[model samples]
Target: MVNKILISFFVRRLPEIRRSKGVTRKEIAKGVGITLGKYDKWEAGKVLPKSEDIARIASFYEMSVDEFLGLTEEESEAIKQKLIEDAERLSPEARKIVVDAMTDKQA
Candidate 1:
């Protein structure tokens, strides 16, 4: 499930990020492969995008998902470290899965 707080943060940050990139909403929508109306709704906070769509949009913005969601670099790094620490407590196979997913490389 999507975090409501993250979605709210993303909604508030979307326009700011777009403006900083000097791109229009339509451009972002097209780049991210979402409909312009859907992108409009996302910016308007009428609805949240699916997780995959959120990832796509972040990729389009050339940002990490946390960055795209308005987290500071320190905040993102802290979260990553926390996840890594937590994953260390999991079973070996699960830990490998988590590490691989995070690194996008063989664990």
Candidate 2:
């Protein structure tokens, strides 16, 4: 028989990450399909959401959880590069909008 273990790390960057992306707590709560108070708890490091919620937030930010937590700079850059490459396949107008939005958030 084989045994497997699962480990999870919770880093509270939700507040900062949401702010950096110009997203309000309410918006994140709605997007994550959770109550605002629950989201607030998650952001304040008072609690952790389900793994599904973590994945949903990462998807919303177009980043992996590790990248969202600022854990792996190089890996995060690789993810950004991949996203950029995928964005390049979009129509010029769409690409421009996405690029502009990305640029605006970083500013």
Candidate 3:
């Protein structure tokens, strides 16, 4: 029951999130290594992403999959909130440097 609500909310909120983040759908598709049609389907609530794809999308937003799906507990949300605050304190250059370092580490 809860899962269904979360899934519905996630499907509805995804495109809003992307737009709020100022990233194009094409950019999100390329970043997630999915085709634009598939991304569009997910955004349109015509399909649900696989768990792995959900995780990938969550990572792109720098959020946990549970949080991205609006299924996070208060404590988990508080932690994410703190992290977001800290990130927001960084200068754009500093943020880029941190992002680049993380990307390099991932590679």
How well does each candidate superpose onto the true structure, as a TM-score? 0.62, 0.52, 0.59
Q: Tell me how far the alpha carbon of residue 26 in candidate 2 is from the true structure, in angstroms, after superposition.
A: 0.2
lDDT of 2 by residue, 1-107 (tens): 11111112333356668888999999988986789998877765567764446556766787755555564667656755765786677777656644654454355
Give the Cα lDDT of each candidate.
0.72, 0.62, 0.68
- List the RMSD of every prediction in angstroms: 6.8, 8.9, 10.4
Q: What are the runs in model 2 whose C-alpha is more than 4 Å off?
A: 1-12, 73-107
Instruction: Kindly list the per-residue Cα lDDT of model 1 for residues 47-97, writing each as its tens digit.
Output: 877545655676687676675666676776776687678776777765654
The most accurate candidate by TM-score is 1
- lDDT pick, better of 1 and 3: 1
Total backbone collisions for each predicted model: 0, 0, 0
**Deviation from native of the Cα of residue 56 in model 1, angstroms:** 0.6
The superposed Cα distance between candidate 1 and the true structure at residue 68, in angstroms, equals 1.6
